[model samples]
Target: MPTFTAAAHGGPVKTVLVGRAHNELVYHGDVLNTTARIQAQCNALGSQLLISEVLYQQLEPQPAGQFARRGQLVLRDKA
Candidate 1:
């Protein structure tokens, strides 16, 4: 079975084009990196989805049992 992971964050990002043809559009910024790092943790955490605290806080209140706290994770390239 194929497993998937997800993470979210709200912030600005810098967009740029790279490669010899300069046709590849890329999103570059801390927000993107942070989200990716969080997504990567899904395998280790054994969860289908992992969301960042910032995104969780931005969400509307949910049922008491809807979301479980997984605690803080020390992501790569982050202090």
Candidate 2:
């Protein structure tokens, strides 16, 4: 198994998710969850990176149209 490292750039987020090809498993964990959320946000906003409010705090006056505020979202059960 290959381990992946990820970092968020915009908002205040504690965790992130990511997905990878050539992997048997689909939902790895919060990492994967984050990846999905990022993808969804990108589709909605048409950007590359999706950051949380916390991250945005660190980077003020960030590039516009790159991030969208995703208010508290309830994630589904993780197995």
Candidate 3:
């Protein structure tokens, strides 16, 4: 998994896969919350992996160069 920086958290965090387990190290509250937020951000930005749009607009040369046109995406949100 990639360690994407969250502007809200102000550091790097890695997302882990989720599974049915009741161990602290195997599955903890903080770990689960962070991963959820990262997934939401990635989905909102329409990328497989992503940072916030705020961060993207501030790049020197603009990291947008690294992304290719994957075509327009349509997302469904719960009401």
Candidate 4:
């Protein structure tokens, strides 16, 4: 999974996946959360294995959407 940078109020964190990158790992995260009722409604279907949008876009010879659509991850807005 491509680790995307997140700019916290203090500064940018190298490991925090945010924006499009966070979207990539979320499907994996869903593996655990899917058992609970609430997460199923909010996350991608358990079958949609995905990579980061940046890499997916660079995936040439094939269309990017083969893996996942751009900006498909539904992240809760930061408070």
Best by TM-score: 1
lDDT of candidate 4 over 9-43, digit per residue (tens):
12122343457556532233332332232233233
Give TM per candidate: 0.80, 0.33, 0.30, 0.28
Which predicted model would earn the best lDDT? 1
C-alpha lDDT of all candidate models, in order: 0.87, 0.51, 0.45, 0.36
Q: Per lDDT, what order, best first?
A: 1, 2, 3, 4
| Distance from true location, Cα of 29 in model 2, Å | 6.8
How close is each model in CA RMSD to the real structure? 2.1, 10.4, 9.3, 13.7
- lDDT per residue (tens digit) for residues 1-79 in model 1: 9756788777889999999999999998889988989988888888888888888888999999888898989898889
lDDT, residue 1, candidate 2: 80
lDDT, model 3, position 31: 38
Give the winner by TM-score: 2 or 3: 2
- Order of the predicted models by TM-score, top scorer first: 1, 2, 3, 4
Superior by lDDT: candidate 1 or candidate 4: 1
Clash pairs of candidate 1? none
